[model samples]
Target: MKHINLLLLLIVTTITIVLLWQGAQTREKESQLLEVISRHSKASDPSKSSDLTRNSAPGGAARPSAAAFEPDHFLTELNSLLDSAGTDSRTVQRAMRMFLFDNKGKLASASPKALKEACNKIEADWATDAKSFVWLELVSEIVKSDPAWAIRNIDRFLMTIAKEQPMEKMLHYLGKNGRLGDPAWSPEYAAELEKWFDTAEADGRLKGMDEEAAGMRFDLNISLGNLLGAVEQLTHLPEDSLSTRLEDLAASSSAPSGQRGLVEAVAAAVPATDFQDFTRALSQHAGFDSARELLARAELTAERHDLAAAGIAAADIGPQTAARADWLITTLRDKDAGAVTGFAAAWTQAAHKDTAAWLTSLPAGDARDAAVAGFAPAIARLDGATAAKWGLTLENPSLRTSVMDHVYREWHQQEPEAAAEYFGR
Candidate 1:
């Protein structure tokens, strides 16, 4: 009997110790949960509630009721928790998005004023510039459903911390949605955008950028193509003002060559009646190199071919002609060899006052021989006997043979009997 009582007492003592340890662990878990709830409640309240209102037990700590676990309350507490924990901005943003997704039904039913207030809260709490931009984007989306709100806030807070990306995205969105030209939103929005571009250009903000980057930043191709289109559609600005603005944009040397090319192409598209004045304006404002390049490009155009020929004929034999001589030669080579010979003869006559003297002064090589060959046909056509005499004077054997063959062909075709007697001699 004594052994049995001692064993039972030992078992009882062990059970008591285990129970006490379990109780302590349970209390510790409860304390941790309460602390979490307290922090959550504090973070959720803007004023930070000091009073710990909870269901208290006799001689025990306060405990939260099921009321605190309501869906809306839980989301608020979670948001507050995330914000106060100094979580990364993107992480917080994602978490908030998830919360919205989970409670999308509630959000859908929420009033506009409530939604705006919530967006304002998000804007105020988020730390990063990216978060602020996201808030604005959200606002834009929300206001799209409310046209009155959109009109009121379209220009307000339109800018983002990122230099141009947000505005560009917004503009693209507006254009894609056909809201940019909406009469209900007022034409002032488009005007505001134009003014912004003008201001940026004047401030040199768009200057000195690399070609590809500047093209993207300024929407160079799209803007230039649509410049007149905008004036016609928007009607907020005069055509003359827009034209002057385009001229200013084109003349900026800091802009890329492609931009200048677009300007030159537009000028070339002008009617013949206005072409002279257009070119004159370009020359006055776009500098000498640009003017020269514009003229060269214009000369290459199909419509200006005759004009190009006339201009080349009238052009003096100077540095300008020399500079353009290669292009002119290449252009004329495929069209008419006679014209090429005539141009060369003209250049020589102007420079040296004698084509034969210019030909003799040329260096002895294939280049000079080619020049002789090029001029031979024209010379033969003019006077075959004189051409044959000049052919014998050529130092290059190949050139002499080629010129003689050409002269004989012409002399034979023109006067075979005289050619037969001259050959027999």
Candidate 2:
């Protein structure tokens, strides 16, 4: 009987402990749920409006209120309400802020020391209660007003930011406000910022950054190339490296021909004085135009005494692309009327796509248009329908319109009645 009683007592104790533990967990969960509900309920509660404003002011401080800010109260006994809600930090913060705004007289009465203490508490608790950006704003205001506390704790508090999404918001706030460049800029901080920037740039996800938040803080605060140190840490690239890591990627020959433009553009923008040699050495596939551009830069100008290299550059232009951007100028001044029509045919085919891109990419002026227009007769043969559609997407709208009108005239000479249907009513 004694053994059985002892065993029963042990079992009862264990059951009681388990019940208590579960009850405690239930209470904790309930409390957390209530906290969330309280946040939303307070936000929507019309009565909290005045409270929110007063506390949001720069120096709004909490004070002894004339009456308890309404919160749920539980009755302890007759004529006694247990003050379940009075003086909670969040409640106090909102009410004090609202009261301060509603009556500056109340704010004026707050002692400076008290105000500072209240601000510190509210700011310290912000990361737990407010949005992450809210904490940034709170810290920023705190740092601006109370650099003493910030200088001491900013590092510790900032770790909370890394866990948040859209970390750029926090980074931008710090970077733009000059905090990123502060004496606190450690090697670890710089390395992380560079990693984030390179990742964002690589993924093409850098668009969310506002113009003011464009560059990393180090980029703004340090010398232009100083951020190179962090990038160097990544891959220990060459001393004169200018190309991004992506420049190394090559497309397989089986890829679509349309992808050629993107590949060529990336390769051209890459930093390589000897790109023609490097690319040819790397793969069976390479863009001849890009190769020619590299070699052309090595050509000597008459001014530079490298004129020997100019002919070399011209030769490298690969018969396909160099199809004569050269003398066609004086040629199209084609003083020969019969040769004019023939020249037009060749020019139209070469200049079909990105014609305006080519024209504008050159030195600007009416001169270029006049020269390119000499090929207009060629363009006419290329597209009668496109010529008719000119009013829509023409470059140099006025000049193109006139050119179209002239082409119409020429077409009229060839077949006047047929041309009327194109250019005329």
* Cα RMSD to the true fold for all candidates: 23.5, 20.4
For model 2, residues 1-425, the per-residue Cα lDDT tens digits are 99999999999999999999989976765454344333433443435434432334455563323222211110011001012223355543443333323333333444444434544454544433322322333344345434445433444454453454444544544463354333444444444545545665686655555333333432332322342232233232342442323222332222333333433443334333323222332222344444334433432222121211122222323343234343333223212222222223344455555443344443534435553454554455545555445323434678677777766766666666667886664
Candidate 1 versus the native: TM-score? 0.29
Candidate 1 residue-wise lDDT, 326-416, digit = tens? 4544444233233334445445445522445556656664445545564555565556676677667766776577777877787777878
Q: Give the range where candidate 2 is weakest over 10 consecutive residues by summed lDDT.
A: 73-82
Worst 10 residues of 1 by lDDT: 228-237
Question: What's the TM-score of each model vs. the native?
Answer: 0.29, 0.26
Model 2 score (lDDT)? 0.40
lDDT of 1 at 344: 52
The top-ranked prediction according to TM-score is: 1
